[model samples]
Target: MYDEMSQLKNLLELIEEPSDINLDPEEKKAAQVERLFNMLFEEHEEHAKIVADQLNKSVEEIRSLPYSEFRKVANDLGVADSLLFKIPRLNRPRTFMSPKDKISSKLFEGVLPPGTNKAEIAMENKKSTKELSAFVSVDFDMLPNIHSSQEITAYDREVHDAIVSLYVDGENEYITNQMVYRTMTGDPTAKLTDKNRTEIDNSIRKCSMTRISIESSPQEAAVYGMQTMKYEGNLLYTKVVTGVQSGHINEWIYIMEQPILYRYATSKGQLSRTDINLLNTPVNKNAETLMLQGYLLRRIEAMKHPKYNKSYNILYDTIFKHLKIEAATSGALRKKHSKLRDTIKKILDDWIEKGFIVGYKNNSDKGKSKSLSIIIK
Candidate 1:
């Protein structure tokens, strides 16, 4: 019942208004309301009937109820306030952006080797560890004319961050490429250049084209309180529209976020927050640095207590994998690994100096494999 109501709530909130006709405010609203009921009856007949029965009314009667009346009755039906509407949480900082924790923890990586467009990364679920094939595989198929790597890059992450910010629980967004650019640049007045527009366009297409497949064992399903669970879809559903009116060109991008992510975001312990300024931070403006900071932010946000150690250890190999760094030879790999350690330490030091963290430490593990783990504090 809750799920059914939730879907209806989303429908009421996100229904589009008629744009072609010129009508008075009341007439426009009346047209929209009529269309909404028609859609509910046609597409969601079963759920609409269920809701109607809950209100002691027939489906037709419920459909004919005034929009305001239906909303009032729905609210009176004991759905939690937060589930029905957006309510500010006390613990979250106003300036922070909350993304699904899995993505923040490296579901999508920086870059893949050229000529390869698929990534089969390990899913970060404890129950699935015993299963040999538990993974979240992503494949990006780009349109012909895009020159960059087809895999999800830091630039793609920027576009993703911007698009995810627009999602309220699970609502789709209608936006322009310029809007995406502005969101990333953190400037309302930022104008999209040809380069910026092209990047945004490519990123949007790649994200939509990217297919995600999650595989888990029966044990994993039981742990998640389900008999069977599977997810396979694009990260986002994107519709690109280009129209020429009176010799003027207009382009609109419509993005529908994946439903499972919304379910996770609204569920406990599955969402994480990061400083909204990270994307536009002047300290290290490069995409690689932004990606590193994003990965670190997830660790920071996972602190169990305020006074708990604000540091954690990550295997060098894991870091390399998350950053999608590769070397052709063993000697070259050692050199790149050493260089990466120093670079990461420098980046964390800069973060501390900029007051992003109170203090920082880079403690190399003292073990037989001494350089295996980098302790970031």
Candidate 2:
């Protein structure tokens, strides 16, 4: 039931690293469990008694159970199976990209400068400067296209999507420009040329500079095990290192998933994985499609039904929020809302044609009940 004491200590050390490593509440609990077991293995009867009480068994019975059986007993006591089996060593395939539910739902919805009116004014002024110089000096021609804080767009979210593959925890992660290129382009065979490499670098810089703040309800905070309901931080922090002698460059990107966001990632149920290749394709590249898809991806996963038989009921106002639609008057808002309904129909029709979904029904009644009922395939 116990491994070598030295091995157990090493595992605890790895989990409790003093760096900027962010462990969700469950991980901290897992660490506590390891500490308890280590004490029990050393014949600590009090710790054994605690587990025995929880499981309604004798201290000897609790100690006699194998580690696997102990996990099952703890699972029966409401410990998550993922924490017991998958967290210490995640075994996810490389094909799927796991973006946090909060990020997916809010990141593209006018949060990161795109879809906001301020972005339009900034684009017209065109005062973009070179911000990547802090990371690494490059040729004038090699600079990213939009370097200013206000120039973030839907395209930048693509970079965020790609980089999320590196965001397992709060610790800084290393990646090369080539890996970003492959992930963003969704083709492992895609070449890393000068133009696209500059684009990737620019996007990274843009993401690092953009700030985001999320305010969650008490219910939401409790659901994700967050101690607080409010969070404010930048989405990313990036440092680039160039090997002058080897002419190679690598990026150390720190994904700052705050307590709420980190809990969303660790909860497993609060995250959604999209096929990288299909998501980056030209068909889903537009802002509306991207925003709607992001919202749908997160919402669809929460549906309590099997696939091909499930449907989603989305409100017109909900679509307006996700798509960031704004209007000056009720009449104009209604017009734009009507137009957006058509736009959504066309987008859903395209999805149906591509066989991504089966069909949808419009339940708009020209009243407060305007909504869309979409059938999932």
Candidate 3:
């Protein structure tokens, strides 16, 4: 197993080249990248399974094994030794740190715009002071700070209190290093501030009407529709619709929607419709109202089951099937029509090229039809 793991890792490394060192370079690159990613994913899953299987053993017995012996066992089972090393790193960081600081820092970093002071922005966001302090302490620990951990703790508390006071007094819009220093010095106006009230007001106004488009990708549309179903509180039924526009070739979209029904029951728990139309909308569309309607029909068909009791569900299922079947038939007709149109266009172009079809005759309809007598062949 160890040998197999090493072989697989070596294979992955060999294929990591940007340019293919094998046949059909472009095709090779595409295949190799896909293969590599899939291989890594499968390897991780296999390693997890091995670790889970080990959980059945007694903890003391497991711990009694030396690192070398454990590595050999894992190797025999095809688990990569590097993966075992990574497990400690992955699990230890959180156990040694407080959740408040680490979790809040991560969340704050994600939400705040670039160039914002992390510690100050974190505090302004009402994050726990002790957590932020611990987080900052860890960060400062990596640096060559002369201050002792005890001194750092005291400084963090003082700064936290001062920042909270200014926040309450409306003197500071957010916490910052400078603000902390000013508060410590007992000077209110000593820090440089960029709490631009105008900017804040403008941001609020701008965000209120902000429209977020999902970029109309098929996967994104499907996920969005599923999310909408989850939002409507129905976890069971999630459906996705995908197809091309009948009349518009090379155009495709998906739609995701939810169907929900609730009724008052005599019992404390409400008697709800057995069939939840949790997903009842088109997940993707090309802005065509008619096409969107067709997409919705497909989703409805996917959700239909006899167990569903809601009258609306039954009606929706019936209508949706009718619409979907009609759209499919119409799509066939449109494809034939488009093919005929293309044929006519090609015939006209060929005639024109051969001098068999000329430009229209004189301005009046009385004039003879455009000449097409010349024979090029």
List the RMSD of every prediction in angstroms: 14.0, 19.7, 29.5
lDDT string for model 2 (64-119, tens) is 57666765554454432222221122222255354545444344444433421222
lDDT of 3 by residue, 148-232 (tens): 2211222222222333333333233323334333433333344333432222222222221121111112332243353221111
Give residue 372's error in model 3 in angstroms: 75
* Cα-based lDDT for every prediction: 0.53, 0.50, 0.29
Best model number under lDDT: 1
- Per residue, candidate 1 scores C-alpha lDDT tens digits across 227-258 of 66556777678665332222233445656554
Q: What is the TM-score of each candidate against the true structure?
A: 0.52, 0.42, 0.15
Reference-based TM-score, model 3: 0.15
> What residue pairs are clashing in model 1?
none
Per-residue lDDT value at 256 in model 2: 36
Relative to the true structure, candidate 1 reaches a TM of 0.52
**Measured by C-alpha RMSD in angstroms, how accurate is candidate 1?**
14.0
Q: Which is the winner by TM-score between candidate 1 and candidate 3?
A: 1
List candidate 3 segments past 4 Å from native: 14-109, 113-377
